[model samples]
Target: MIATDTLDTPAAVGSSAPAATPALPRGLAGTPDDKEMLRSAVELTRDIATARPEVYWPDMLLSAGLGYAALAGAILIGNPVLAALSGVVSALALYRALLFIHELTHIHKNALPGFRFGWNLLVGIPMLTPSLMYEGVHTLHHARTRYGTAEDPEYLPLALMKPWSLPLFALVALLLPIGLLIRSAVLVPLGAVIPPLRRLVWERASALSINPEFRRRPPEGEFARMVFWQELGASAWALFVMWWSATHSWRPLLIGIAVISLTALLNQIRTLVAHLWENEGEAMTVTGQYLDSVNVPPPALLAPLWAPVGLRYHALHHLLPSMPYHSLAEAHRRIVRHLGVDSTYQKGNYSGLLPLVGRLARSTMLPR
Candidate 1:
């Protein structure tokens, strides 16, 4: 449940007044764990913990295949209206495929066999967002001691920020395709020769993170080897795309960027509601983290479109991070049935996207 207690900081009533950083309300300062809820979550969903290779392979391949096919239609078709529709389809499909990176992070290296390689080849490298960008980085966001804190790369206190930050957050995603293009095509290649530049890129520009202060440490051992290959593949693909655009018409490349830009916009909007963003750089209890996160469950039919691959149940995800995407729905149903409507579990459930966004916006407007 969201804490109803209010922040006590002085109000920033005028533009001239500097806004003080917001704090988590006293009621939420050190919320105790809901042990019953945590135990039940584990016990109820144990059967569905295994990642199914069959489901993962077909779904990812199909999504990537459809995305590329629609992208081709969008670029080649002369009709403006049809091309626009194709672009939308391509964006949505590719977005879903790209999100499989989340699954890649949680699943064991051996769980899905060559699934990681397949994904990087088909979707990740092509998009210039290889798994290396997320693999080691995202797990920190799930760490019990790091979540919602300054150490968490994927977290920020957005609800405690100025009102304009919300729109700015989503708007920045529109430039992601261009930013990624430069990173892979120019930065990665240049960084290969300049050790300092490579180190800087790895620390600052590698992760898909919201917290500007979080810097990724150097990769080591097996993961370091993985990063090297993934970076090489992404850089090569980016350079090839640049060469193709220079030799051929620029229409295809430009259209592809536009489609990816739409995908990034959709992802950024989804990120806005992924959490309440109320924690003030403090480590949260499991229950606090669950409440801070969100779940847009059944009957809100459009959620799957915006939060695909079981992301609609994001709060539940924090509870069972290792649970495969295909199994989250059933796990949600079982947990909800066991815990009932009034449980802390249900507090994470929300109606739809707009209400959550409005709630975050209103929180930002509260006295700083």
Candidate 2:
């Protein structure tokens, strides 16, 4: 089970007098007043924070259905025009289904047991992105001490890095399918038999991480069981894909791979603008972590398409990591409506993804 500890820091929308940064963990500190204010704001929105089992089931089922139907129609139907139309739809639906993994990491275990198992069976195993890869790694990204640091497995300060790194960052997702396949088909089996190799795989190969130096510890207890089952499913899927391609026809598997690649590419773009990337591995104040994060608020209709699963309000998420996905917009609305324009919360809102990316590019290229 995931840790359900309440963060001591408050996640409020209103601004108050600046207080001295209170002592905190090695990499994070923030004013107690700030924490308290946020807590008050959060309490106001607490009713909506509970997960809705009803919403998750239909959404996953429909997206998975659309993705599979479109893919099958595209591959089996011989018409070029119909195939093109279906292919585009297939890519988007598949992307949405895969995106649900982000939500899986945050959802309360008791809330959606069947969805978790179904997700692993449908999108996770076939796409080579099992929940095990993200279960432990993603939580660290929200840790007050690790948000912008090298230790945060999911983080890398993209804007602060060399300009060349940006293109490499976006383009690298195209190679992920191959990499994931290698991890499942080659490394997983080998590591199970070899003791030394098992350590290396657990630490270096298991996580879905952006930080090159970050390493994960092997899971114990229930998490270890999760890893075992998920890895078995993914390995079996990978083997099936290989056998299917060799025996049947490559058309369907190729189309599925294309959709998965497209999903990764789209996710990579979302990750690019997720943060300002201003902190250079510093243990930041809680407020500092809030400032570095981004929220592409409404009027950007496309924002949800690219950063769905409640990711559009990313900064708010940093403030209240335990809040359920469906409730985030209501939490954001409640915070902003009550706090007004002058609030520190306003600092997290950006106009759109392109503007955020443009600002980061300019920040990196132009003299400060």
Candidate 2 residue 327 Cα shift, in angstroms, is 0.9
**Model 1 error, position 101 (Å):** 0.1
TM-score (all chains, Cα) for each model: 0.93, 0.88
* Candidate 1 local lDDT, 1-368, one digit each (tens): 34545465775666676676555544343566789999999999899999999899999999999999999999989999999999999999999999999999999999988999999999999999999999999999999999998999999899899999999999999999999999999999999999999999999999999999998999999999999999999999999999999998888999999999999999999999999988887678898888889999988989999999999999999999999999999999999999999998898999999999999999999998
Q: For residue 115, what is the lDDT in candidate 1?
A: 95
- Poorly placed runs, candidate 1 (over 4 Å): 4-29
Tell me which residue pairs clash in candidate 2: 10-35, 10-39, 11-38, 11-39, 12-38, 27-283
The residue pairs found clashing in candidate 1 are none
Model 2, range 1-368, lDDT digits (tens) per residue? 01112335543557574644443432222222256447656787878877887888888789989988998888887998898788878878888888888888887888776888999998889788899988888999988778788898988867667777888899889788888988888888788799898789889988888998998887999988888999998888888888888899987777766766777888899898888877667676666677778888888899878888788988888888878778888888888888788877787899998898888777677553
RMSD of each: 6.9, 7.7
Q: What lDDT score belongs to each candidate, Candidate 1 first?
A: 0.93, 0.80
Choose the strongest candidate by lDDT.
Answer: 1
